[model samples]
Structures are given as structure tokens and as C-alpha cells.
Target: MNLYWHRRDLRGTDNRGLARAVSVSEGPVAPVFVFDPTVLEHAAPVRVACLLEALEGLRAWYRERGSDLLVVRGEASDAIPRLAAEYEADAVVWADDYSGLARERDRAVTAALEDDGVACESVHDSIHHEPGSITPNEGAHYSVFSYFWKKWRDREKREPLEPPAADALADVAGDPLPSRSELGFDKPTATPQSVTQAAARERTTEFCSGPIYRYADNRDKPAVDGTSRLSVHLKWGTIGIRKVYAATQRAAERATTDDDRESVAAFQRQLAWREFYAHVLAFNPETVTENFSGYEHPIPWRNDPDELAAWKAGETGYPIVDAGMRQLQAEGWIHNRVRMLVASFLTKDLLIDWREGYDWFRRNLADHETANDVGGWQWAGSTGTDAQPYFRVFNPMKQGREYDPDADYIREYIPELEGVPADAIHDWHDLDPDRRAQLAPSYPAPIVDHGERREGAIAAFEQARGE
Candidate 1:
């Protein structure tokens, strides 16, 4: 008997590891999902809720196929081997997961299973190319994105494996799925609570069919929903990257104009960025907790409780920054452009450590990934590999005017700014104190002076580099 362990890859369709496990199984194949406490211990409420919904969907899927999903709650090393013993399983198969504590846990479980004489197998199902597969001609990993992307495009992608036939697992002992509360996690009350594989598919189809062509033109505007909105799905492996890549390729081929092709290409490049960061993480796992370039510098970060509270509550008095923070709190997600802006405001403007923002995002964002979140925060702080230049600072007011010229995004999240004129919306400080108070009575004053903070950030980076 063979066991297929579900981790991030929750869906049944087009699942690389699951399909492979079914294909090689000689007897009844059991599908298992472990509510590993080690992983869930740190998961935020929203992420916990989304994971429960996905597992519920997977349970129904296995049931309809006349098989069962065995859910174990404990340390994976104990749970997986215990389950394997129950089934007298010859081998255990699973999708390979990358870093964070999950990777370490997997390693420990694999070692334990191998020691117990159970064959353990892993398949790459997360990203298109394995981390070490693509490298420079000199046999070193490519640190630059464009060069990696060029090679990424040239490589032939593997055809997505078909979903296993129903006959693959006609009979197996099934287990019940657990609720978030059952696992000692609170249920999230957010817009993404209803997310499922079917919903994810619909979202993918809708974006690819219509909005994708104009993605490059409008992706920066948070007021407009121009993005794929599939990051959560991708992060959790609810959908396959190959499937999305194939769909994009097909759309590109059907394009009647060069502009359309370029749009598709641009979207595809973002996908490459996803993999690029993953590769970086694979090469240097320490990047999760330290500077990617090994730059060691002492930063005199403010641990001001009031400033941190203001930033988190979206009372920073900067409309763009506040909108991004509020949106993240309300929906457990934020736009890509705003993600950069807010991260910059936190790390650069407030002079807080990037780790603070990183940890917060890891707790809140439903689509959070270790590699992507770390890459983003460090890039904003200019301390990461292939990061933005240290001296370059993003002016929040300018970024708002450039991306959200009409103040539509600001109004959506910062309702107090609704009556403020578009011209003055980006610079509330210019208004007289009494008039500004009348317009946004509930909004707090800007927590930090941007001009001074910019200079401080530059000096801090220079000092760090010298160290």
C-alpha cells in the first residue's frame, strides 16, 4: 500500500505528487493530511481558516472517489509513522515543501521514517523548476532575476500530469476532517473565508479571460482589481503552476496584437519572480532570519509602542500607507504595489526592523510565503539579495499620486479621507490643523517625518554596509 501525504498541495486535480503516488500504487492507496501542530501553532487565524476550508473540500473529494482522507493531528514525525504503521504502508509519498519550520519538520519525519524502514519519497510539485535545476554556465546559482528569467523561458516546462482516474483508489479507510477550533486555532472572519478550489478555478478563468490583457496597465492601482487574485491559491498549492503557465501560454498564442502578447509576458515574468525568490531561499535559508548578502549592521530601531500601534491601526495619517494596512487587516491580503509601499513605510520610514514587518505579514497575509514575504520586506529595507538600492526611498505621497491619482483606493479604506479633495489628499499636513481635524477627525497625525526618516534610513544603510 502507498500513502500520499498532502501538505500545501490540497487539491485533487492536476496534483503532481498525488497523481504520481496513485500511478505507482499496487494496492489500496491512502490519502492523508496531517494537521501538524508544529506548523499550525504559528499560523494566523485567516490562514488557519483557509486551510480548514481547503481540507474540507479535499475530504469531500476523496469521499466521492470512494476513498478516505486520514487527518492526523500531532507532530508529523509521530503522526506520519504512526499512520504508516496502521496501514502497513510500504512507502509514503508527498509533495516537497520548502523552508520555514515545516521544512525542518519534514526532514525530521523523513529521517525517522527511513530509520523505521519505510520508503519515503518526495516529488517537486510546488514550483515549475526545482531550486537547483536552473544555474549559470559557471555552475553557480543566478542572483540576477532577468538572467534567470531568460533561462527559465528557454527551458521546456513539463506537461502537467493528469488527475488520477477514480479507479486508482477504489477502497481505503477514510478519516474525518477537523475544524480550526478543534486544532486550537480561531476561525478567521475575513473576506477570504469562502475560498475553495472551485472558487480559485473560477477566479483564474475570469482573470485570464478578461482582465489579464490589461494587467500591466492597471496592476499598480489598488482601487482596481486588475490582479489575478490567485496568490493565496498558489501559496497553498490549491492550483498548479503548470496549469496557470499553460493557460497563459495559450492566451498569448491567441493574442491578435503584440500588446496582448506583451501583457501575457509581463504576467509570466511575475511568476518567474515567484520562483526566483524561492530559488534564493533554497540557496540561502538563512535569508529568512538574516541579511541575504551577509551585511551585518546595527540599526537603532525605535521600539516605540505608540508608533507601532498607530501603524498597525491604519492611523498613520498617510492615506496610501493607511489604506494598505487597513486592507490587510480587513481582507488578509494587500495589493502587490501597496505591499511594497507599506513595507517601505514600516522599515524605512519608521526605522523599525524589517523582521517586525516580516513577522506581521507572516501572521496576517493569507497568501504569505516565507521566501516572498522575506524578499519583499528585505527589498523594501534594501538589505536583501537583488534588492532595491539602499539610497532610494519611496515617498509615500508621491507613490500614492503616481499609482492612485484619483484617490479612489484611499477613499475605499480611509473613509475619513472621502471628503478631502484629491489635490490635498496626498498631503494632509499642508491643511491648517483645525481644517484637517474637521476633515479627518478620527485619523491620527503622521507618526514619523518622512524627510528625516529618509535621511536616517540612508545613513543606517551606509553604516551597515561599512560594518
Candidate 2:
């Protein structure tokens, strides 16, 4: 018997590891998912809830095929071997994961299995291109995105594999599925709807049929539902990157004009950004906590608890920043443009460390991947590879007017501003004193003067650079 361990790759279809295992196993094959305590202890409630939903879906799918999924909770290194011994399984197969902790856990598990003479195999299933596969012609990794993406475009991606046959594993015993509350975590009564392979395919089809052609022009506007909204699905492996890549290529091929094709191409390039950050994380794990370039820039952060609380509570008095923060708190997601704006306000304008904002997002975002979260925060703080220059600060009011000209998004999140006119919405100070009091009685004034904060940030950056 062989065991196929599910981790990030939650779906059974187009799963490279499960496919390979089913092809090679002669005896009964069992699918398993281990809710490792090491991971669970740190996971946010929403993430834990989402994982449970995915696991339930997988279990139902497997039950229909006469096999069952074995769900367990323990250290994966010990759990895999113990489960193997119990089932007398000959080998274990799984998708290769790229996070530092995941890599270390896999190493320990593989070593223990090897010592016990149980064969363990890992297959690449998560990323479109394996890390370090598309390096520069000089055999070194490219630091910039354009060169790497150009090379990424030329490389051939392997066609997605089919789902494993159910008959391949007929005699395996399945364990009872556990609920979120059973694991000592409160199940969310109202959670974001889970994304399955079918759902993802529908979304991809819908996008390609219409919105994809307008993606380049519409993506930055938060008021419009322009983005793929598939980040969480991608993070959990409900949809394979290869599948997305192939669908996007097809869209580009069928596009009626060069501009439409270019839109699809641009959207595809964002996927490259996702992979590029993952590769960077694999090469420089320290970037998870520190700057990649080893620059020790001292930032003078404020210790104002009330100000921090205001920022967290979405009462920062900056319309754009407050809208983004509130959106994240309520929806477990924020638009990409708003993400940049809020991050810039927290780190650059408010003079708080980016790590604070990063941690806040990690606790709240349903789509939070460590690589993307860290990359985004550092990019906004001007401490990451190919980051925006430190001096290039975003003006919140101006950004609000540009991205959400009519203040629709702001009004949706910041109800206190509902009565404010569109022209004066971005600049709350423009309201007459009596009207401002009547419209937003409880709204706090802007926490920091933008001009002074901008100068402070610039001077701090100059000092750090030895100017």
C-alpha cells in the first residue's frame, strides 16, 4: 500500500503527486491529510476554517470512490511514519511545498521514513515553474522581473496531469473527518464561500469570456470587481497554476485584437510575480523577517498606542487608507491597489514599522501567503528587491480621487463619510466646520500632517543612506 499525503494541494484532480502514486502503487492506496499541530498553532481562525472546508470536500470526493481519507493531527514527521506502520504502507507520496518551515518538516519526515526503510516521494505540483528553473543565460537567477518574465515566457510548462483513478485505491480504511470545533477552533458561522476546482474553472471561463480583455484598464479600480479574486484558491491549491496558465494562453490566442491579447498577457505576468516572490523566498529565507539586501536602516517608529488602534480600527481619518483597512477587517480581503495605499500610509506616513502592518494582515487576510505578504510589505517600505524607491510616497487623498473618483468605495466602508459630497470626500478638511461635525461627529481628525510626515520619511531615508 502507498499513502498520498495532501498538504497545500488540496484537490484530487490534476494533482501530480497523487497521479504518480496511483500509477505506481500495486496495492491499496490511501489519501491522508495531517493537520500538523506545528502549523495549526499559528494559523488564523479563518485559515483553519478554510482548510477544514477543503478537507471535507476531499473526503466526500474520496468516499464516493470506495476509498477514504485519513485525517490526523500531530507532528507530520512522526505522524507519517506512524500511519505508514499502521497500514503497512510501502511508500508515501506528496506534493513538494516551498515554505521554509514546510521544507524543514519535509526533510525531517523524509529522513525518518528513510531510516525506517519506507520509500517517500515528492512531486512538483504547486508552482508553474520549479524554483531556479528559469535563471538568466549566465546561469544565475535574475534579480529583476522583466528579464525573468521574458525567460519565463519562453520556457515550456508541462501539461497538467489528470486526476488519479479511484479504483487505484479500493481497500484503504478511512478515518472519521474532524470538524473545526472538534480541533478546538471555533468554526466560523459566516465564512467566505470555499472555492473548489469546479468553481475555479467557472471563474476562469467567465474571466476569459469577458473581464480578462479589460483587466489591464480595470484592475486598479477597487470599486470594480476587476481582479480574478482567485488568490485564496491559488494559495490552497484548489486550482493549479498550470491550469491558469493554459487557460490564459488560450484567452490570448483567441483575443480579437493586440490590445486584448496584451491584457491577458499582463494578467499572466502577475502570476509570474507570484512565482518570482516564491523563488526569492526559497533563495533568501531571511527576507521573511528582514530586508533582502542586508541594509540596516534605522526607522524612528512612533509608540502611540491610540494612533495604532485608530489605524487598526479603520478610523485613521484618511479616507482611502481607512476604506482599505475596514474592507480587510470585514471581508478578509482587500483590493490590491488599496493594499498598497494602506501599507504605505502605515509604514511611510504614520511612521510605523512595516512588520506591524504585515502581522495585522497575516492575522486577517484569507489569501495571506507568507511570501506575498512579506514581499508586499517590504516593497511598500522600500526594503525589498525591485521595490518602489523609498522617496516615492503615495498621497492618500490623491490616490482616492484617482482610483475611486466618485468615493463609492469609501462610502461603502466608511459610512461616516456617506453624506460627504464626492468632490470633498477625498479631502475631508474641505468640509465646512458645522457640516463636518454634523456629517462625521465621531470621526477623528487626520492622525498626522501629510506634508510633515512626508518630509520626515524622506529625511529618515536620507539619514539611513548616510546622506
Candidate 3:
């Protein structure tokens, strides 16, 4: 018998590892998922709840085919080997994960399985390409995204695997799935609308069918529904990256005009960016804590608890910044452009450490991912490889006026600013004293002068870099 272990790749459809397990097995394949406490304890509550929802979906899918997902809870090393021995399984297969902790866990499980005479196989199903597959002439990982993107675009991506047939699964009785509270988390009442594979497929189809034609022009606008909104699904592996990439490629081919083609290309580039960050994380695992550039000098961070508190509360007095923060709290996700802006404000404007913001995001984001989160934070803090230059501070006021010119995104989250005029919302603090007084008392003024803080932040970076 063959055993297939499910990790982040929760979906039954187009799963490479499951297909491989079925292909190699002379007998039925027993699909199992173990809720590893070591990984779950450090995970975000919302994300854990989402994973449970996905698992329930997968369980239902398996049951419809007269099979069941063998759900277990404990250390994977012990549980997997025990389950394998009980089932008399000779081979175990699973999708590969690139994170440091995941790699370590896999090593332990693999060693234990080998000791029991069980072969372990890992399929790189989650990402379009494995980390080391695409590289420079030196055969090392590409630290620069442009070089990586060039190679990535030229490489051919394999077609997504078909879902396993009904007879492929073993008719094995399984334990009941656990609830959020049972897993040591508060019960999450609602599954976000975009949690399931059906929703993800529908969204991807809708995007490639229509919205993708305008993605180049509209993706950065926070108020517009221009994005694919597939990140959450991608995070949980509800939809395979291959399916999304294939769909977008088809869209690009079907393009009737140059503008349409440009839009499709732009959207595809975002996918490349996702892979790029994953590649960065795979190579520089220590980037989770240390700066990627290895700037040894200490950056003098502020000890203003009130400032940090206000930033987290979405009352930073910057409309754009507050709007993004509020969205994160309300929906467990935020716009990508606003994410960069908010990260800049935290590290540069507030003089707080990037790790602080990274922690908050790790705890709250429904799509929380360690690699992407670290890459983003380090980029904003100007400490990553190919980071945003430290001197080029993001002016929040300009950002609000530029991207959210109508102040629609701000008003949507910050209700207090709803009544304020679009122009005034972006510069409420700079208005005449009478005009400022006329605004609601509930709305606070800017926490710090941008011009003053800009110089101070630049000086701090220079000092740290020994310029």
C-alpha cells in the first residue's frame, strides 16, 4: 500500500504528489493529514481556521469517492510512521514545502520512515518551479528578481495533474476532523468567501475572462476590484500555481490587442514576483530574523509604545496608512501597494523595527506567509537584497492622493473620514486652522511631520550604513 501525506497542499484536484502516489502504488492509496502541533502552535489563528475549512472540503471530496482522509494530530514523525506501519504501507509521498522549519520536519519524518523500510517521496507541487531549478550562469540562486524573471519567463511550466480516480483511494476509516477550539484556537465562525477551491477557481476564471484585460491599468488602485484576489487560495494550496499560471497564459494568448496583451503580461509578472519571494526565502532562510544585506550596525529604533499602539489600531493619522491597517484587521488581508506604504511608514516614519510589523502581520493575516512577509518587510526597511533605497521614503500624503485620489479606500475603512472631502482627507492636517477645526474631533492629526521625519530617517540609515 502507498500513503500520501497532505501538508499545505490541501486540495484533491490537480495535486501532483497524490497523483504520483497513485501512479506508483500497486494497491490503494491512503491519503492522510496530520495536524502537527509544532507547526500549528506558531501559526496564525485565522490561517489555522482557514486550513481546517480546507481540510473539511478535502475530506468531503474524498468521502464522495468512497474513501476518507485519515486525519491525525501529533508530531508527524511519530504519527506518520505509526500509521504507515499499521497500514503496512511500503511507500510514503507528500508535497514539498520550502520553509526552513518544514524542511527540518520533513527530514525527521523521512529518516524515521526509512528506518522502518518505507520510502519517502516529495513532489514540488505548490510552486511553479523548484527553488534551485532556475538559476544564473554561476548555477547559484538569483538574488536579483529581474535576472530570475528573465529565466522564469523562458522556462516551460508543466500542465497541471488531473485529480485521482475514485478507485485510486483506499477505503480506510479515519478519525473525525478537529475544530478550531479543539486545536487551541477560538472558534472562527465564518470561512472567508475565497477559502474554497470552487471559489478560487471561479475567481481565477472571472479574472482571466475579463478583469485581467485591465489589470495593468487598475491593479494598484486599492478602491477598485482589479486584483485576482487569489493569494489566500494560493496560500492554503486550494488552487495549484500551475492552474493559475496556465489560465493566465491562455488569457495572454487569446489577447486580441496589444493593450490586452500588456495587461495579461503585467498580471503574470505578479505571479513571478510571488515565486521570486519564495526563491529568496528558500536561499536565505535566516532572513526571517536578520537583514538579508548583513548590515551589522544596529539601527536605532524608537521605544514609543504609544506610537506602535496607534499604528496597530489603525489610527496613525495617515489616511492611506490607517485605511490599509484597518482593512487588515477587518478582512485579514490588505492591498499590496498599501502594504508596502504601511511597511515604509512603520520602519521609516515611526522609526520602529520592521520585525514589529512582521510579527503583527504573522499573527493577523489570513494569507500569512513567512517568506513573503519577511521579503516585504525587509524590502520596505531597505535591508533586503535589492531593497527599496533607504533615502526614498514613501510620502503617505502623496501616496493617498496618487493611488486613492477619490479617498474611497480610506472612507471605506475609516468611517470617520467618510464625510470629509476627497481632497481634504489626504491633507486634513495641512488645512487652515478653521478648516481643521471644522473636521470631526474623532479624527486625529498627523502623528509626525513627514518632512522632519524624512530627514531623520535618512540620517539614521546613513549612520547605520557608515555613510
Tens digits of per-residue lDDT, candidate 1, 128-238, equal 998889998874467888899998988888776677777786477655677677878776655673557787778888888878899889789888999999889998887
TM-score of each: 0.97, 0.95, 0.97
Candidate with better lDDT, 1 vs 2: 1
User: Mind giving the per-residue lDDT tens digits that candidate 3 earns over 233-305?
Assistant: 9888889998998899899999999999999988888888888888888888888988888554788778478
In order of listing, the candidates' clash counts read 1, 0, 0
Residue pairs of candidate 3 with colliding backbone atoms: none
Candidate 2 global CA lDDT score: 0.83
* lDDT tens per residue, model 2, 124-159: 888878788878776446668788889787788878
Q: List the candidates ranked by lDDT, beginning with the highest.
A: 3, 1, 2
Local distance difference test scores for all models: 0.84, 0.83, 0.88
lDDT preference between candidates 2 and 3, better one = 3
Q: Each model's RMSD to truth, in Å?
A: 1.6, 1.8, 1.4
Candidate with the larger lDDT of 1 and 3: 3
lDDT of 1 at 200: 75
